[model samples]
Target: MNAVTRIGQVGEKAVFRRHHRKPDGRSLFLYGFAKPDGVSLPEGNDPVAKGGELRWHPFRREWNVYAAHRQNRTFKPSSAEDPLAPSKPGGAVTEIPFETFEVAVFGNKFTSLHPEAPDPPEIPGVSSQPAVGACEVVVYTPEQTGSLYTVGQERRRLLLSAWNDRYEALFQQGCAFVMPFESRGEEVGVTLHHPHGQIYGFGEVPQVQRQMASAFDDGFSLERLLPQWSEYSVDEAGGVSAFCPPFARFPFEVWLTPRRRVPGPWDFSEEESDGFAHLLGEVTRRYDRFFGRDTAYMLTLHAAPKGCEQTFHFTAQFYPILRAPGRVKFLASVEQGTGVFTVDVMPEEAARTLRAQ
Candidate 1:
């Protein structure tokens, strides 16, 4: 029978995973996409043919996995008399078909939907009429058998690592700005619980993205300093190191820095990608385990816009909103109308919880 591991002492996925210390140490976990309806793992290492695999979403640049939808994937505390709390027994894993796409450039321009967005939302940091503005999606895993948080760290990192492959190709095709934004689980407001979807593009920068770029005046250089920074903590193939600001904003949010400074996703090389695969797996799994496994999440990429290689730092920002069993910090008056945020739990506390896993 195909085997699946459960969370451990701390009730988190990390407890079940042992980080490797060699270049190939992270790849030690034998991960294969599981087939649906109690099917087994595929014969080869071919990711596309695996039953429980992850692939890219063409519309959004984010990744999706093939796993069974968990029973408590959604968040509707008021739905039933006793709703599913953050801590509960999740459903069995779901598996689905896996598909990956080659890199391509897409624009919001000239598409059938262009006239429809006739007026894109007037964001604060971007231009209303810019040279380019497009959006696309990428699905990572198709293993519909488990919640996104249930996948092993090795597999998770590999799935995230795919971005390096396509980002380089897409940037060449004229994509100036790309951000994979994602929301998971129905209870937490995710539309699909079936492992999938994210968005990106080649065009005018989103207002927020432009503002973030302006944070640095001296143009950065991924070419000059990326190699050393991509995976700061990992030199050996299977290192157990991770990177990020010691103080982060959210629980278990991790940034993969293979080289010292990557201007953006397009500049990441093979080393960065491999490190990302390992780290991402570690981070995602820990997030769910943080709030009683299978927690919902959202991750964002903070990188240099297509042309501004000199002005930005290519970093990822993972936003996992699940604070506890049944509570989330509501974005009330102070946060909604006004652009401010406050967290009840300190980021350090969140980090500690995650690291424990």
Candidate 2:
């Protein structure tokens, strides 16, 4: 059900997110124009989409008209067997000789959110919460590349570079917390074949973030988060670091810790960005090579606690999906009914397997 098959044929595919809402208010995303590769616009230009007219359907309450030049794709609710089980984890590992760094950088123009998605909310949190930060996405590719050989050092650079640039832009707009995230379909239960990532900027933190902060306190700051991973530290104050915990929910899951104690993505230095990107490539490439084919996983950025002091550490987690090749670990009553996550495979075992490759 990926866009690969949906492309070329044309018509229209609407991606519907029933629970997630935008500030302007809309529950549907109808995508039909399969955009060309290596595309990006200047500061003021938008990517070329299909369709002949640019309009919004009153009945549908969504963007309408315009025959997009890109492929068409429709979105359906992911059946974790329930309408509410929308938390999909994408942590696949593939190494398919991804597009060059330059091409990958511009490739993101195809995603639904343009660099010019209007002005972000001044504060963060859902409208239900009133004031807080904003969130967005950054797709990694047009094809699945979370698995072996698909993403390497060069591609990782582009990914991080795009993130770094976007972070700065958000900061200039009076942003306080910039949360960068990636939601490749494999982990998110996406039926499409497109590859992309996301970025979020906000002036305050969300509720879920406040909870994480209250639970752990150790002079936790964004900078210190990066270094935590590299040193595998139980305590630290700043720089770049990464760590794989023994209590990981998934065997291959990794937590990236930064050294500085900043609020969000904009805190990164140029060299730090490059270094982090390379390190990310190293870690993910191992996973991709280990999987041998495309892999499934999700990456989430945790930086700066919301509506509080910057005492929280910045950390990103890599959540992989798949109990084994051809055998997926589905969430039964245990996970669905309760939040208790059962790690079917041991963390050591997964790390060894990944390292061996």
Candidate 3:
């Protein structure tokens, strides 16, 4: 049995989604411009695994999660063994059972957290608890090649809408914080070559997010800060702005945010959504064109924690690790030890280079 929902519309095409449950009890959903064609869900023979636990970090005043199962996840598979690809008519079943799909989302098999996670083992003097949350993988397309930059405009818009849906769903399920992010290329330690991203729902807001909330409560305003770096702007349209911040930690770091503060992607107006998709594509294309190759980067969305929505500003930050075509800006001793980032290029110069692309 399947359940269908009307997601929204892009241009003249109406987007819809169909949900399925994998044999191991994982949830899967397929999204497309048209209704999905019926297909038999595959029955798998894998064992159901348990989730990990979180240990308190005394000094940092944070939690660290340990999921030992992740060490055995699929790594660098050949094209023939790409698990993210859609299953061929008579081929071996993959993570996605669909014969064809525009986009796919499913529960991560080696997730760090789970709703039914067992209680943590007792460690004499240490604080610990079950890591109860959610982790999901979002496949951008059926094709295994090409990055988000090459997915075309309409698909990117659909991707954004899908992310918005996930955010709302996860929050309703009791997550305190949700983050959608993409780790691309080997330099960024991406084990899969497929064009996909992941969404992590945390039981509590992490350290960085807590810091952002504190700064906002103390009167930090992105609207006031953005104007000081107008010369570093890359693109702005439909109430959104994409620019390299003057205090960039990476050489080619770029931050995209709506002109007016919003709690999260779900709060984006229709026009802001379109502009976001356009700017996301533009920033990535510029990175590839400027470096004369596919640049390795980490892309993340920063939104307010569930209860702190009114005080936080939403932003998408792109941190490309490449300082040059072949050189990487590794976080060495000074960076790791002192928490200070040392960059080799200035934000103005980086913006000038990207704009030329």
User: What lDDT does the true structure give each of the candidates?
Assistant: 0.43, 0.46, 0.88
lDDT of model 2 at residue 191? 48
Considering only N, C-alpha and C atoms within 3 Å, which residue pairs clash in candidate 3?
A: none
Q: How accurate is candidate 1 locally (lDDT)?
A: 0.43
Q: What lDDT is reached at residue 206 by model 1?
A: 53
lDDT of 1 by residue, 165-254 (tens): 345544665767766656666545764444544555534465667666775555544335434444222112232235433444543445
Off by over 4 Å in 3: none
lDDT order, best first, reads 3, 2, 1
After superposing candidate 1 on the true structure, give the runs of residues whose Cα lies further than 4 Å from its correct spot: 1-132, 147-162, 168-173, 218-253
TM-scores for candidates 1 onward, in order: 0.56, 0.55, 0.97
Model 3 poorest ten-residue lDDT run = 40-49
lDDT of 2 by residue, 94-164 (tens): 11112212212222222333323333233342121222223343445443334212555554554554565
| Number of the top-ranking candidate, with TM-score as the measure | 3
Q: In model 2, how large is the Cα lDDT of residue 313?
A: 56
Candidate with better lDDT, 1 vs 3: 3
The candidate scoring highest on lDDT is 3
Q: In model 2, where do residues sit more than 4 Å from their true spots?
A: 1-151, 171-177, 185-187, 202-204, 216-240, 259-265, 269-271, 305-309
